[model samples]
Target: MGGATTEPADEKPAVYYANCAEAKRAGAAPLHRGEPGYRKALDRDGDGVACET
Candidate 1:
């Protein structure tokens, strides 16, 4: 019984932003947890939302 989805091991790598500014510039600001380019460092309040203004 499979309950989880399977992803290709060679799938495109996850996105990463050095900082919120970078993310904003890339139009990926306000990233949320579980989304690509989302990091704890980006989430100042640890509210699961990153790069939020």
Candidate 2:
């Protein structure tokens, strides 16, 4: 028998944005450090500002 697979309750699905414009369009802009959608790529300068327009 195969057991059912499940995700942790605290785990959130990743939201990918092609660029800052896309993220802003979705109202997910100004993402700070350690935020769910925040990534080093988004924060190019690594100043903890993600999706800054």
lDDT assessment of candidate 1: 0.93
- The candidate 2 region of ten consecutive residues with least summed lDDT is 35-44
Model 1 weakest lDDT span, ten residues long: 5-14
Clash pairs detected, candidate 2: none
lDDT of 2 by residue, 1-53 (tens): 67989999999888788888888988999889887678888997889999776
Could you tell me every candidate's TM-score relative to the true structure? 0.78, 0.69
lDDT of 2 at 46: 86
| Among all candidates shown, the one with the greatest lDDT | 1
Cα RMSD (Å) between model 2 and the true structure? 2.0
**Per-residue lDDT tens digits of candidate 1, residues 1-53?**
88988889889977989999999999998899999999898899999999899
Off by over 4 Å in 1: 1-10
